[model samples]
Target: MNNVRSKICGITRVEDALAAARAGADAIGLVFYAKSPRAVNVQQARAIVQALPPFVTTVGLFVDASRCEVGEILDALPLDLLQFHGDETPAQCEGHGRPWIKALRVRPGDDLEAACQEYVGARALLLDAYVAGVPGGTGQSFDWSLIPARLSKPVVLAGGLSPDNVAEAIAQVKPWAVDVSGGVEQAKGIKDAQKIDAFLRAVRGA
Candidate 1:
């Protein structure tokens, strides 16, 4: 079986980004959402990107941001992927000339198959926990049984995953990738090297 990939989201500092990379994270996420405690500006993003080693995908995350705003960030640095963590339609997510993924908060009564069909153009689908009015970064997990056995696109499981439970999550969900933000953090935007290492180790062991 192919080892599940990992993405360390909401990376702020160059050190944290390096820590994740050294720990064998396939990707690191940089939040562009202003309201997020982990949000990073063009300068911060650039610095983090520049300090990283080769072959590490840099993902730019946004939450209901304007097209212009996203464009400006893309214009500033090289974000290998875009993560739309808000209510962006397929049409709106398109035209960026870059590969993108849609984050859907899993709530009861939601049709995930329809969402997969809706964002058919996405490279993958990210499933997160649903918190009323909160887009993501909720340390609380949702029902894993909610995910279907099959979908049109690859699934990148998120929501409250940590070192202790990631093995079980990967074994159960069997997602294409796993995303973590607050799980490995020492603070809101600061990552603990030990936690990051342990998280990656757990994913590998899983």
Candidate 2:
């Protein structure tokens, strides 16, 4: 119930990021994909990262970006982790000078073991619902039964996770951590502090 780390994703504002940190988020995600409504550029991300207090993990989310593109951002950002939300090869996710996670859009009958093995380099595996044409932030929940009881790597359960259902999710999936974006937001790229506090409270109380 307790010690289940939480990440507030799709942060676009310094104040919102600070709110998440103040609300006890173990990590805060900064989206980098240009097409995403929650995406933040270098200047924006830099400011947000700078504003965060100690021990809050800074995650950079990228969607099938090129190595050159990732490298460029790596040079400028102070990200502690990378979440690959697209079909990036293990090698592509590697050598970015930060620990990385691989996000798999889970669907029925998908070979999660193989995928985990393939991305063996990832510190954790982020499992999100499979929504067509949407890399992430769709606020969709996947069937928890589909996830194997045990995986080679830790599972960062995502998709449609909010304070309302997260308690049930933590009981059912027992993920190493949980990630929420739209669930804690007032609008796209805008987080609600009350929602964030409620969500973290639920996580701790679950």
lDDT of 1 by residue, 1-206 (tens): 35999999999999999999999999999999999999999999999999999999999999998999999999999999999999999988999989999999998888999998999899999999999999999888899999998988899999999998999999998999999999999899999999999999999989
Could you give me the TM-score of model 1 versus the true structure? 0.98
User: Residue 107 of model 2: what lDDT?
Assistant: 98
lDDT of 2 by residue, 1-206 (tens): 47899999999999999999999999999999999999999999999999999999999999999999989998998789999999888999998889999999999999998988999999999999999999999999999999999899999999999999999999999989999999999999999999999999999999
Judged by whole-model lDDT over C-alpha atoms, candidate 1 comes out at: 0.95
Off by over 4 Å in 2: none
The CA lDDT of each predicted structure is 0.95, 0.95
Give lDDT: candidate 1, residue 12: 95
- Report the CA-based lDDT of candidate 2 relative to the real structure: 0.95
Total clashing pairs for each candidate: 0, 0
The TM-score that candidate 2 achieves is: 0.98
